[model samples]
Target: MPRMNDVGGQDGFGPVIEELDEPPFHADWEAHVMAMNRALIGQGVYNLDEFRDAVERTMSHESSYYENWFRAIQTLLKERGVV
Candidate 1:
């Protein structure tokens, strides 16, 4: 019953990695992350470098974007029809 937004996906990016070490189930995860970062930056929420840094610091414990992580991803995917 683990959520997709748990670890950092297989590549330590989206969702947590557990059970096994698998490749990114969806490549769009990266696109979603990038898109979300761009949208947020344009909104003055966070800059490009800031967003990148946040992603780079992602540990197996906490997401740099926090709960907002999943929300942003979900929103973008829904809009892109990639969910």
Candidate 2:
């Protein structure tokens, strides 16, 4: 086996790094993404440069965060009837 490049994996995020791209969104999911983005901001997850740095960090690592993050997001969405 060999070492893989840092930004080369399923969650590596590739060139599609920015969180929002337009086409796949339905109106609600668009709102959902924006709301999530806001919540992240409100929570002080990062300042401008730091957010990108944090995302870049995650982009290079293998992420199991989706398992937990999605469940939490979906649970909220379901409770909110956005699911």
Candidate 3:
């Protein structure tokens, strides 16, 4: 079964626009969210695949990518009783 994030070749999806000069992050909190993901992965708390799966299963399709990352980490931490 296709997960929420697997939109490849799917119809009704809008075009994906690439930003030529997009900033590293649109918000300060986004940077923190990315860092937290990296740190947890490095510490073996969760692998990249696990994070992606959690985000895809847990977050809404309309949620931003960074928001998904934040939600995935929060879910992992709660599962581990770290937060």
Candidate 4:
């Protein structure tokens, strides 16, 4: 079965679009969320593939990338009883 993160060779996804001149971030918290994911990985909490799976499982398409990353790290840490 295709994992939730698997988007290759699939149809029905809408056209990709980019917002011109979008700000680096919509909010400051987003940067923190991203950093947290990296920090946890660097601390040997989890590897990148695991992190990706967690994010895929925890988030829907509606959630922003950073939002998914934040949720994924939380889910992984909680599952490991670290938080």
Top of the candidates by lDDT: 3
Candidate 2 C-alpha lDDT tens digits along 4-53: 32434446355645666646554565556556756855776534454443
- Per-model TM-score on C-alpha atoms: 0.33, 0.31, 0.85, 0.83
Query: How well is each residue in 1-83 modelled by candidate 4, as lDDT tens digits?
Result: 76667889989889999999998889999988878788888999998999988987888778888888888888999999998
TM-score of 3: 0.85
Candidates sorted by TM-score, best first: 3, 4, 1, 2
Candidate 1 lDDT tens digits, 11-45: 63565447566555346665576566678679866
How much is the lDDT of residue 59 in candidate 4? 83
lDDT of each: 0.52, 0.47, 0.89, 0.86
Q: Per-residue lDDT for 48 in model 1?
A: 58
**Which candidate's TM-score is highest?**
3
- Looking at model 3, residue 66 earns an lDDT score of 94
Candidate 1 all-Cα RMSD: 11.0
In candidate 4, stretches whose alpha carbon ends up further than 4 angstroms from where it belongs are: none
RMSD of 2: 9.7
Instruction: Point out the higher-scoring one by TM-score: 2 or 3.
Output: 3
Number of clashing pairs per prediction, in order: 9, 0, 0, 0
